[model samples]
Target: MKKTLPAYLGISFVWFSAHFGGGFASGRQIVAFFLNHQWTSLFMPAFSMLIMGLTFYFSMVIAAKFNTYDYSTWSKKVYGNLAPVMAPVFEIMFNALLVLVTAVAFATGGSTLAKAFGTPYMLNTVVLAAVIFVLTIYGADLVRKSATVVSLILIACIFIIYVPNIIYFFPKIIHNFAAVKSGEIVTGTQNSFLDTIWWAAKYGALQCCAIGAYIVHAQACPDKASLKKAAIVGFFINTVVMYLSYFGILAFVDQGVLKEAVPSLFVVMNGVGGAWMTVLISLCIVIGAVSTGVALVYGTTNRLANFFGRNMSEEERAAKRKIHCISSSAMLVIACWMVAQLGLIPLIGKGYGNIGWVSLLLLTVPILLRGLGLWRFAEDVPGKVAAE
Candidate 1:
């Protein structure tokens, strides 16, 4: 069956695409993280690419080798009760992160449609949220297909708009390169490595590791070799896409102005790419946003059903299920939308990274403890894994 073509890679790409969106969707994140340094943003993604690549290998490798999809089982065996104890915290973090992502999708989608046409933000928001809910209730195949299409669209738009621009800015790129190499220019974002690590932790990278592992377990890969291959492939694909996205933003926007917007990639892109292309990518961004909402909510709902021992509803029982589902969906959307509307950019800015930390602390600690010869102290607890 071609083993489903590694759904995790496609998921990772869509997931990482969320991280690379927002302010970093333009050049701001790159400017903050690597442009301040030498040729590092160029190299930073690669460095992460390498570390994540190795870590991913181990994740799928271990899970697949065990033939056990219950990540909790692995976690407990690796970290004793500590892994089990941390489950609630990880879920809370994930829920909060999902709430926030949903908000971003709604707000961004509304803003884009409002900007492009005379659409009411609320109406646009309602339309988008409804779409997100439908997509979520349906599941991942729709999301993967949607994301694959949207990612391709944005990727094409980025190339068409930014490649020549980068070539044009080659001189500035060189000057920035020499300055960073010579340590002559510091855009003065200190603790940048720690910042990115902290950033990676707070946001999706670390969380995505867990998510990736979950997907691996869900898909029921039967061997360490298969699992590791999946993780490596997933991370490698994600990092490349993220880095390409970073440069695309840089090539198209002025870094100085990008610093001010802080969270809106569109302000930067719309300015540089011409209003029409800006409008086009904005719609694409909104589409990607919907894809994200679909992916997260779909994953979350399935996870929740598994958590609560709920079966997939069939027939008229689905009516009650529908109520339950809509309640959950509404709660998430409204809360996130409120946050988005209230200008919680500063607060939610680290949402992804914070959740990432929780995921890393729970998952990585267990693996490291086990891998580093500390396994005897742990226990194997019951865990459930489902990819249905």
Candidate 2:
């Protein structure tokens, strides 16, 4: 069979699927980070996506260039001699992020479904966890494929729901902007430009760490050229969808929609009301959450499986992958459910910003420097000589 997708698009979809999770699809994270900043919400989302796109491009390039598919080996390539110490520290931090994001997915999925179906939140969460667990066990290839399919449906649903609202609410959007500019309304926590940008950058920083998940698929990226294509394709897909969702959510900010757990759903309920559209929006959120949960769970699973199977022969390791995957997925899903009790707002607000700061200090800065050639991995010496 000819492949269902070229390697580049597959990689791109993986990036999109992993990034557009509960926090994003719900529009709560955008409200928490961007819309609260009022007028800065206009461009800060695009800026934040740019930061993520560039960082993803750089990270994928390094991974492709070095041929380090898993985070364990990739960190070794990135950190050089410092790998002995820094790698384990980075692993702990990265796993914390995995847990945090996956937990948000569980929380977001459960809350949305429970509200829509009038079911128990815990029941909804258990079902959501089961779905993610099934997807995750199939491993990276299935995750990428599912991401592409789920993301396509999500994009269509978003356009159907959001475009109508943006058009209908044009007058309110303009009036709100004017109100913010005139100092008649201040939506942000701090009214300063620097503060808004800092928050936006934190959003970017949290996203940049998804490269840990992205690089596991790097082997599919035949070369740096393919990786670049994947990065650009993924970047545009993510940024465009985010902008659409942001504007739709922005139109309702003045209506106190930001106070809602799922602001995008509020936009659908009030702005684009049909019983079907409400269910559609709810479905969008849950699937998006599942897509993210699957990817993050699988990424962490790959790392753990690799560590435990280090002493095993290739045959032995391959045989054991399913076992490792099951254990890892179960452990992660349970942790995520427990953390989900903290609720959506608290996770996006208090939990994510800290991850972003830690990611910037530990992951993004070093990756940026190394990708720019400001620092060299000892592994690069032979490749550098070959080019000469």
**Estimated TM-score for each candidate:** 0.74, 0.93
Pairs that collide, model 2:
36-188
As a whole number from 0 to 100, the lDDT of residue 353 in candidate 2 is 82
Give each prediction's root-mean-square deviation over alpha carbons.
5.1, 2.5
Among all windows of ten consecutive residues in candidate 1, which has the lowest summed lDDT? 379-388
Error of 1 at 40 (Å): 3.9
Tens-place lDDT digits, model 2, residues 1-388: 0167787787788888888887788887888888887576678878888888777877776676766678888888888888898888788888887877888788878888888788998888899889988888877788778878887888898889999999999899888777876767767574688888888888888887777888787766546677778878987998899889888987876788878877887888798666788898888889888988888888887887887789999999999989988887888888887888777547455878888888888888788888788988556764521111
Q: Which candidate's TM-score is highest?
A: 2
lDDT per residue, candidate 1, 1-388, as tens digits? 2245565545445544444444444344455545444334455666555545555554544454345334433333444556556655555655666777667767766776787787988888788877877765544455555655666676676565555545666676566556555566544453555665554433334444434324423343444445445556656655665665555444433345335443234433444456666665565567756766666666565554333335555554445654655555665656666766765655655454555566666655556455445554523333332221
Among all windows of 10 consecutive residues in model 2, the one with the lowest summed lDDT is: 379-388
TM-score of 2: 0.93
Query: Which stretches in model 2 have alpha-carbon errors above 4 Å?
Result: 341-348, 382-388
How does model 2 fare in lDDT? 0.80
